[model samples]
Target: MSYSNNAVKVFTVDPLNWQPWVETVDVKALTPAQIDVLSEAPGGLEKIGPYYALLAHDPEVLRERTRLFNAVMYGRGGLPRRERELASVAGSRVNGCTYCASVHGRIYNDLTKRTDVIQRIFTEGVDAQLEPRERAVVDFSVALTRSPERVTADDLQPLRDAGLSEAEILDLIHVVAMFAWANRLLQTLGHPTRDEVVLV
Candidate 1:
């Protein structure tokens, strides 16, 4: 597979598979704590994939991480879910995390029914052509992912100008920041492949 960030590749809305580089915890041998943590995670027990299993090595960390993840992504109010998904896609795209991008791209497409935008982003880069509002979200997410230190009040103007409220902008920032962390964990722990990947 091409590792280059700019290389054009097909991105599908369908679930992509991922595999862990390290040995993941065996589901059958899971401890009560690990099972509890995994149960609270996105897919719950039956869907505890290799990634979650690996993290389950430390049930406490995984528990806290799962709680925060669920709250951030599934929380009520503030930014609309679709824009949050868009920000995630932008961050993953910038980080070169194909798996994260594909997953979030699928969510974004499901929410907005705009597969073309995700297709363009995967084919192009974060600078892919998009609507004004989407452009603002993508640009901010890319900037934050590429260089968080360089982002400033000026950087947020575009979001505000695009009609986002302060709360929504804050939500956008949180989503981008979360993806920055999430993408790193995923890419560093494993690699995306078409082989026997644990489908989420």
Candidate 2:
């Protein structure tokens, strides 16, 4: 229940039951650059968890990353938040990034209140049987993540057909690509807790 970003508590099961398995950088020993970078963390990095401190090793990149991430994920327009979260889930799943999938799935559920698609994602793939619009977004996300080289402008036809405007299409692409990179970063930087454990 402690909230200090500088403490060195044993990384245990998160109350949310989705803790990062890797050790984060000690928040207290953070350099000035990292401090400055994290000071401007979007959505309050501390509230988001310890991963921001870890990524703060490269304050410049982390700043741009967080800035862009906040704008894309929490922006005013473009794909609906639910669809954006779905794209994150799709990209994370295709990239084999369990942490991103879990977190985004939770957001997807919270926003959409629909577990059927989440279950579909788990049992099948992002391209599982879905409503037409959902299927289009998932397909775009998966294809973009798995084989970016093979993807073409034509690949976005389904989303367009689903009534996504050009701006929404671009936003969806950015969200998917962002998760593709973010998922790889998370997988390489830290593992995630597999079970719930929150005694503290």
**TM-score leader:** 1
* lDDT over C-alpha atoms for residue 44 of model 2: 60
Q: Which ten residues in a row have the lowest lDDT in candidate 1?
A: 1-10
* Candidate 1 Cα deviation (angstroms), residue 74: 1.7
Q: Can you give the lDDT of residue 16 in candidate 1?
A: 65
* Candidate 1 residue-wise lDDT, 67-178, digit = tens: 7777788799988899899999889888888888888898888888768999898888788889999999999988988998899999999999999999899888889888
Q: Please, what is the TM-score per model?
A: 0.90, 0.81
* Segments in model 1 whose C-alpha atoms lie over 4 Å from true places: 1-14, 197-200
The clash count of every prediction, one per candidate, is: 0, 0
lDDT of 2 by residue, 53-172 (tens): 567768889889988998889899778999999898888877776667777888888898777887788767666899999989999888888888999989989988999999999999
Candidate 1 C-alpha error for residue 49, in Å: 1.0
Q: By TM-score, how accurate is candidate 2?
A: 0.81
Which stretches of model 2 miss by more than 4 angstroms?
Answer: 1-24, 42-48, 195-200
Top candidate (lDDT): 1
